[model samples]
Target: MDEQGDPMPGATVKVKGNEGNGVLIGTVTGPDGKFSLNVPDRKVMLEVSFVGYVSRLIAASDTVSLKKVVLKEELKNIEEVVVTGYQRIDRKLFTGAAAVIKAEDAMVEGAIDVSRMLQGKAAGVQIQNVSGTFGASPKMRVRGASSINGNQKPLWVVDGLVLEDVVEVSADDLSSGDSETLISSAIAGLNADDIESFQILKDASATALYGARAMNGVVVI
Candidate 1:
């Protein structure tokens, strides 16, 4: 039975002897939350347990007619941290196309940097290798370039602050792999342990928050 006087079916009733180790003598309660067990002619222990409720231990008399028991419900609340943008908002309240990748989930065994680890981590976001070299900074694009001679990188934001400092690489620089191949991404300076998650916002909602600078999209870390 529960604390509310309601019958709790399927509760386990065990007739454990003096030593309660390796004993499997137990039975589940009936529909009316009642159980009967046959034990030796000696004082033993009765262990009552149920899921989502506290377990109870009672002394079983050497005679018959055992006492009734009641169980109590256990309630719990959980808060999961999954950042999406500048502020935390419920999924039902936010109308944006966003993908969040946890640092622990995106870590690769032999990945040299965070940029390669982010490859294929989000939808409609491309993280391509600028060169075949191991230390070359990868190119990331949320969408196709809007202009031929304009800034083509996605907007970078770290903890609600826009980061304007970035190494600009032209198409020719990428082909020859000489000018910016050794230059690391701005995110490379950040400690991977300090990074919680990467949130990529890819729609009008991104531009609405940062204006034309976010026309390409937003990468919030």
Candidate 2:
């Protein structure tokens, strides 16, 4: 029986050698999660894996029976994997705290500006909208402003590449500045549908890789 007390029918079962290299010898657990496969008389390893289920491996002996094997579903957290600097790591293994916001959640508040979508999405991050204009820009800060004279903006990285001097135009730019002037917009050019996930690195350990530029924070898109 599986964790839910239901039979794992059509569960894929594999037989492997001790070195973790082997073939897909056979499968087990039909609609009832029960099946059998013949193995050699030598000490060998057995691995069972199925979609939406956690894989399990066990050592089998000649006298072992293949009855009553249970398979359980894998429960994954949405924030389990975080973008750390230029790399990705399991959030539990990370030494610092970070927040992850999916594209779907970002659109929940009907936020047209990409930065506005991040408002209230993270615990420590703060987002301030420049205005209600159609092309207005939003300012983002992790924790709080850390620099007095230098730029307090966090570094932005998209698809593993560092984006330099990313700028956004405020509503004032549209009302007061030349109508033909095109202000730099960071999130305006990005396709929200194409975004897989975003990570806001606020802790020191998470931003340490970027050196002084990331002292305020880092945003990985």
Candidate 3:
């Protein structure tokens, strides 16, 4: 099951050695996120993994017949996984203009908004607060505007959910304001503390996945 208690279809379930190496038996979860495997005589570990979620390894027991497993959404430590448009690649092998801002660097003491956290952090990205009001969001542009007929704002993605249009988050879900930090519409409703990291994708090579919607650029969080 996923963190939402919904069925996590297509989750990989593999049997590994005690040391977390060598696959013994491998299968995938069904529509209900359930699986059954015939255990071997020796002690072994069960490894389960899914996209957009953290992988887990657990001890397998022949005596047990049923096991309930849940996969949590990955919120941090994505240094190895670099999301480049439609696909994910290794950070070392990516050949695009993708700049990564680690979680620790963005979660500063007084950082209350994504604009403040990203200010002066990424290259070719400009952030300026237009209003001084308590809830005024800043104006952000990646490599300046790319289109005159459409929006010039960069597309924002949080935990794989893209926000190209207006966002409708509950007011009660927002964090308390420390003065005015109204920044951008795509990122205005986000909580800084909950963000794991920020990946600014510039250049046409990095923004090609979204087609015309990514003409300005993209920010994967």
Candidate 4:
């Protein structure tokens, strides 16, 4: 672990079976002090041992999937670090409403479009798929539409690049069946599988990053 009791980066991780004859698997933790290993589909007793910490044993079955595994620090005197806006703060020093959704929960919605899966998932943000057309994209608005002339659509940022004209398909196009009439003139393309997570920036404090462009809001994909 780190000096602050967090997972130590570059820490050596070793996994072995209860039987001494089993092969030894070795790996190093990342900067997040996290490591993942994929073993064969079989019943075995797995052991995780680090340099300075006590070894831990876990029973593994063919059907079991280890999604997240957290290792506890041996020392009890170290303090934990809390991440904040461009800074690391103590958890006891901050007050705010924050929610985190895992991959399992997001997949359970069975939504082909990422925007549709966000419905009823987050407050203040609204998602509407007004068309039943095959591969029809959804309409998303954070907080609410603020402008009449200017675009009400949120800014879509993929990776570190800001996607220009993210909302090319207007509501009128969907309603008037213009999108259906034109085979190759549909909306801008975006693959949902490429997205790791979606974050909606709402309220003035969150929307201030993009200046006036974020008056409507922003979506980080």
Per-prediction TM-score, please? 0.57, 0.57, 0.53, 0.49
Cα RMSD, model 4: 15.5
Model 3: lDDT of residue 136: 51
Better of 1 and 3 by TM-score: 1
Tens-place lDDT per residue, model 3, 1-221, is 87677988899877765335453577888887887776674477778899878988777763352366778898765446677757877788788888888877766675545666788888889887555456555567886865555556677878777875354322222233434233335666778878777888887765457677677778989
Clashing pairs in 3: 134-180, 136-182, 137-182, 137-183, 138-182, 138-183
Q: Alpha-carbon error at 3 in model 4, in Å?
A: 9.1
Shift in Å, residue 217, candidate 4:
1.5
RMSD after CA superposition, every candidate: 11.6, 11.7, 11.4, 15.5
Which of 2 and 3 is ahead in TM-score?
2
lDDT value, residue 162 of candidate 2: 73
**lDDT of all predictions:** 0.72, 0.69, 0.70, 0.54
Q: On a 0 to 1 TM-score scale, where does candidate 1 land against the true structure?
A: 0.57
The parts of candidate 3 lying over 4 Å away from their true place are: 1-80, 147-150, 165-184
* Window of ten residues with lowest summed lDDT in model 2: 174-183
| lDDT, model 2, position 119 | 82
TM-score, structure 4 vs. true: 0.49
